[model samples]
Target chain A: MTSPPPPSGHIARNARLGIVLFVVYVIIYAGFVALAAFAPSVMAREIAGVNVAIVYGLALIVLALVLAIVYMLLCRDDADRAEDVAR
Target chain B: MTYHASSIAVAVFVFFVGIVLGISFYLGSRARSAKGYFAAHGQIGWFVNGVAFAGDYLSAASFLGICGMIAFYGYDGFLYSIGYLAGWIVALFVIAEPIKRLGKYTFADALNAKFNSRGIQVAAAISTLVVSVFYLIPQMVGAGALCTPLLGLPHWAGVVIVGVVVLMIVVTAGMVSTTWVQFIKGSLLVIFCAILTVAILARGFRVTADRASIKPVAATQPSDIPFGGQVVSIGNGDNAVGASTGPLGPVQFLQKINDVRVVQWTAKADAAHPGTTLYTPVEKQAREYMLPGGSSTFKGVRSPKLTDKLDFISLMIALFAGTASLPHILIRYYTVKDAVSARKSTVVGIASIGFFYILTLFLGLGAMTSGRLDPTPAGSNMAAPLLAKTFGELPFALISAIAFTTVLGTVSGLIMAASGAVAHDLMENVFKHHPNENAKVGAAKWTALCVGIVAMALGTLFKDFNVTFLVGWAFNVAASANLPALVMLLFWKRTTKSGITAAIWVGMLSSLAWLLLSGPAYVNIYKLDATRAIAPFSQPGLVTIPLGFIVLVIVSLMTREHAKPH
Candidate 1:
């Protein structure tokens, strides 16, 4: 039987990266939720006649775009570093 | 319940189902190899896969559940849209590329990629199957609901029809047919809903107080009609009553809401005639309510108090997180070619899904004031279609047919995902029972068959419950069980096989336990007094999601010294 292998150093480093990103995500989401549940007036001024709930609803639209850019940068850097280590 | 099966509606629905089947057959014949059967040989076009993502992701809850919620509950229902879309951020940023790179067929494959442990396989596959089936029930029920009106058939027929059609879709092309079907359904669902939304906005709110002008049949009496239910008396009086022509015919309504307050039918019994009930539309005089001012609009807009506010917020969190973490949606990453395509397709999916959700806001509110809300909670499902009926039978037929197809698209995607887990993940990898390409395809066929039966049984058992309500429980389960493990596995290198396995097990069991013992489940499903519910909070994401993370951290710490050296 093949012996079990340990996670590579790259994998370990990537894991750390993932933790930081996740914490960031939780903070952003919590902030958005607080604004939506509590700050309808700010939302109303931003979008006329729109409920805070609805504007907060649009937060996902903004979040998706931001997350896409972040993923590309972080994952590409990690992949490049892994290649360098291999060489 | 009335048999107004226009030949045009029947013809349109059958034609749609037929085209989907034809595509399935073509794809099935091509899916002879295991690679083809499991992942479409990773050859699916990015555009097609992207739309298929919408198809697979949308499901019955997105279509029927959200619409029903909006129609009945006002702005609260749209909160689901927010939650579901928000979850995708987690998917796109965190899981997509890594999932594409690591796994070949199922989510289990990716989890066990580094560990190569059989326990991980079993744990992950069990979660996949559990979540997939939980998701499938609502799709089947939605099919049954749509079929009753669209095809003028019974509930079970709709369930069977969807099951057989979906099974065929899976057995024929595997992912190929499933993907294309989803693409077509997804595109059409969004476009048509957009049209409906426009129609809704174009025709804004109208208030009327004509209490007796509108006439709705309350009950149908046995006249000379051959059907299950029919109208014997057509009385214009407010308390006129009727019975069904047969045992199961549509019971006509005398008093029904037609864009105003509740209408109550009062019947006075005559010595010879007994008493009869008639329809009377009630008028609601505007009463001043307090509006609390704040964020988007009303600085102090008068809305209901603390309980309503909490319920609304809870629902939004569930939708936002739920979308990113669904088992069915996560599994779609494997079918695409590479990471870039995965990200691109996700963007397309977000656009399509986001657009459709916005449309639901209109469709739902349209139904609310459509003045056609059925009094029973069960009838709430018909809000959108009934609203369409107010416009004309043609619009009603179109919406009903689209609703049926919505169920079909969602159910087909779910069955395909569940079958992949059985064929590719559990059977080949964990059990060490490798089948050839042909045999693997055979296994998938059988898996789809078994899963179809389970879905049907669930649909029938949940026949009385609202499909949307059941879906929220599914979202909670999905977010809790799968999200913790997936997130930890991708991000934490200290995540040992034991840690990952424990996270999944803890997440799955705790959420399931919370759901079973929660107040809502107790009152709605168990038929027991809600006060007996064991868990204080119903939504498990707040608790089980954190518990999963903690368990992983603790288990990893304990096993660190014994960890294998790199």
Candidate 2:
């Protein structure tokens, strides 16, 4: 049979962290969608030789990766601390 | 514009399929147990599972559909790339660890973990099947698209070949073989596309005199410029062709294209010839070509209509919310040992997928400026393969073979999810059957075969729709049906069994109903006037997704007494 889930405290901590990060991402993503829908001219303006649409799109992809790394690192620390407490 | 089956392409395709089959057969003996068949015994390494995630997630829609869209429509396709990758953020952050902890075989297992209610089991399993079938259409459509250029076969033949081959792969070994297949193809796809991107950068934009060779036709008169013909004119004059900007930087490539005018085609009813349509080239400024709304699919972004704008937002929202809720992707977390492995693998998936999406921009734009685009509506799916052909026949063969594998990897994952829903969730859990291990495996294999046949039929039926657009509808259904229950179950303390059950049904049915009555479905599926569509917008997420959440909360409150204390 499969083992039980991790301690509720640990799971709860991770859930809190995850939800916070998810909200941040949702806001950023919403901003992109809003601009594309409402302000086409803003997205049309060129930045660094490419338009803002391309730049912002690339940024969203990059930011997701960066945040993923951050979440992973922070979770690892939490796991390590939990281990210490258990010991 | 015409594609002939090359000896080299056929050989490479055969070699790729042979190797993939060989792996499945070798793994078949090891997957005799139900656990082995369904979840690879939960022993997959985090890294392999991670890349397998990339392999499974980057469907034919990502490789062929988006590239084709960008080739024809510019930045709008990349918008799909961005939305698709961002959905993984939801996957990585909210769903990964919890799903890994709860589920054993299928997504249904996770949803039914706390309650063990037959209602949840049935609802979630049906959702999995519905979502899987919807998702399979795009992969099957993609398979048909690839077969034409790769084997010089008709679209139906391609769909059939993929159906038969994917069935063999799934029925033989299940998740063991599927994971490895995804890993292999995922790595190869990324590596090859990176190579293709570098080649694109090196070649840059060349001012060709092909347009000058063609005699200009009046707007009222029929033109001889066939579909897929290059009509780009550089410099000041209408027919003027300037010097090549050799070996440009990525940024410089976009800047250079800003000075060039691209000819986009629009099809209208023929005035002179009855029962035939005429495709006329309309030259567009660089800004119009490079910006968002260049294609008909995303033209709503630049439109004044509120419903049009809402359609665009709904599509993006569905894509963002959908990734976390996909049955196939959720099941991948079960392939790994524990929640930590699930987390680690999701990070790897995000990194690989994000990087590949970034490459899609370069690859799509490369096809756009390659002077080799097939401008016909049907030709958009062939953009990437044709772009590779411009490089040489060998690159074309390799990319086509890899594109075929992209279809196989995703289709196998979807079928696995479906079969698990049938055998593990529906028959065993919901129906309360205590089947032996061998019997369960047998049931799953049978389910795989049946699903494969259904996918093949649908693939051929929906051959004309863009694979990416079809995938968007699948996303809309998946997100609306699956996301609300999943999120509430994980986060809310008062989520009851009835809430989960009611949410899945409400979400799944509402989204499906909305889609069948939407504008796109009216024109494409029903063959009726688009103006007669009942749904206000083409995409259903904005209405249906929230409806899912609200229904769940109200139902949970009403059924509060049914909740068992933890």
Candidate 3:
């Protein structure tokens, strides 16, 4: 017999979460790019012993990992619940 | 300025290649079936697959190009690091699970899963080959770049060496061996770069004496300098001072850099000589050196011209959208068991890749002040290796070997993707062949051999061309061609097979057309006046990516009534 397809409820829920997180990130990243392109002088200003350009660049890298982990955890819980309901 | 062949470097490089070949042979028996050859039988653990993502994604450009750019131009190179890492956010959050659930072997498998359209099979398979070949050229060029400095070999020998080694790896066990090779290289690259970063932090910066004496030389080429060619100089005249800042923390290093005066070089057409260029030194605050606009690549950001600003934005958008659409990266999702494994592995990839990008800032700045830069145009690609040489011969040897593996891992991945496109998508699906699993495997091996040879030839032919623009073209085309079709197919129920096919062809061709007729291509590739170019700017993503989405939407609406219900 053919195996059953994955529950659409779980898939839909995960896509929803993924889109929300992705939208959130795009806004933040757009801000970084805009500042560097249009208002570079502002990015050159020093803050906390480092320039804002360096600060914002490093923060974007860290924030990607942070959001990725959050999505993985949230999706894991949803997958587990869907599995239990299927059984 | 000169490279000598060292016995230690050769020994280390040989040992690395030997181990890679050994693993490929060891795994050769496990991949006899078609599934095993393409997707490792979906048996690889999430962790191995995750690091393999890092290995596959961080090509020679990420390691050597970014470091060299930063060594010469300061903070401008870090912009690439930021853009490259941010693309992973799109990959993990949006593309991972759907791709894993849909695809069995290749990216076309996922795009064709719903309709089983012959048109899609042809379009996507062709797109995969085009993107893969474009991406492969730079890695081959990188191999030549490394070989000249580390192994003292000619450019053609480097390309051939990498081509043959990757062929053996892919032809032996396909994805099974390719994944493991990527894993080992990824792990070693990260660990050693972390070690190098620590050394940079410990050494800190020192204000050295000015070395501004001009040596007169015969100037025949446009890039040849008439005078004043030092990479960096500190202070001027009697005010020059020599001091050391000892060991400083990462933040402290930036702050110290702002407090010094650094001399940077600018090239201009010589008034005295018609065809030759003159290099002149300009003194500026170290703070300006630590900011953007220090290099020509990023000078657009500070330019008042509207096209210049649009070009920068266009490139950033392409980079952000490209990573998720790459065929090699997409095919990697099938190596794991399920969608959950894909998600987890992507998280691991983002973590490893993100951390390495953060370290690039330190690596680049460290090379900037390392006082060992090669000032020639070719020397920019050698920044990281030359920096390692300053530490000692062993670090240099180890770093060079890791860099070589970097080329091997990326090239093998590209060949695997290309082979899958030919054997599985084109031969079986599009051409209506009824081959058994073993025959399919054999066909894929032959295809890999052919693709590897083609990559070597292109690498040797394009030896003198700037590889940076070739990589940018790959990203722009991949984003435009694949991203619109894949994203729309997954989300919009009205997306017709005709729409997907139309979008792929439009996106791919438009981006390619725009790149070839653009200003940069006019100057660099055609040897013509850039002002007369047809395209408004160099980068095409700002126009073409949106055009892909619009074409898909319009075509789907037009073909909606006749589409079969899923």
Please name the candidate that would achieve the greatest lDDT relative to the true structure. Answer: 2
Candidates 1 onward: DockQ, in order: 0.19, 0.49, 0.50
C-alpha RMSD values across all candidates = 8.6, 3.1, 3.3
What CAPRI grade goes to candidate 2? medium
Deviation (Å) of B542 in candidate 1: 1.0
Q: What's each prediction's TM-score?
A: 0.81, 0.95, 0.93
Span of 10 residues, lowest total lDDT, candidate 3 chain A: A1-10
TM-score of predicted structure 1: 0.81
Worst 10 residues of 1 chain B by lDDT: B248-257
lDDT of model 2 at position A70: 88
Comparing 2 with 3 on TM-score, the higher-scoring candidate is 2
Which tens-of-lDDT digit does each residue in B253-273 have in candidate 2? Answer: 777677766665666667786
Off by over 4 Å in 3: A1-7, A77-87, B211-242, B263-284
| lDDT value for model 1 | 0.66
* Residue B326's lDDT in candidate 3: 92
lDDT by residue for model 1 over B280-311, one digit each (tens)?
33322111000122111121122445433454
Which run of 10 residues does model 3 chain B get worst, by summed lDDT?
A: B227-236
For each candidate, how many residue pairs have backbone atoms clashing (under 3 Å)? 55, 1, 0
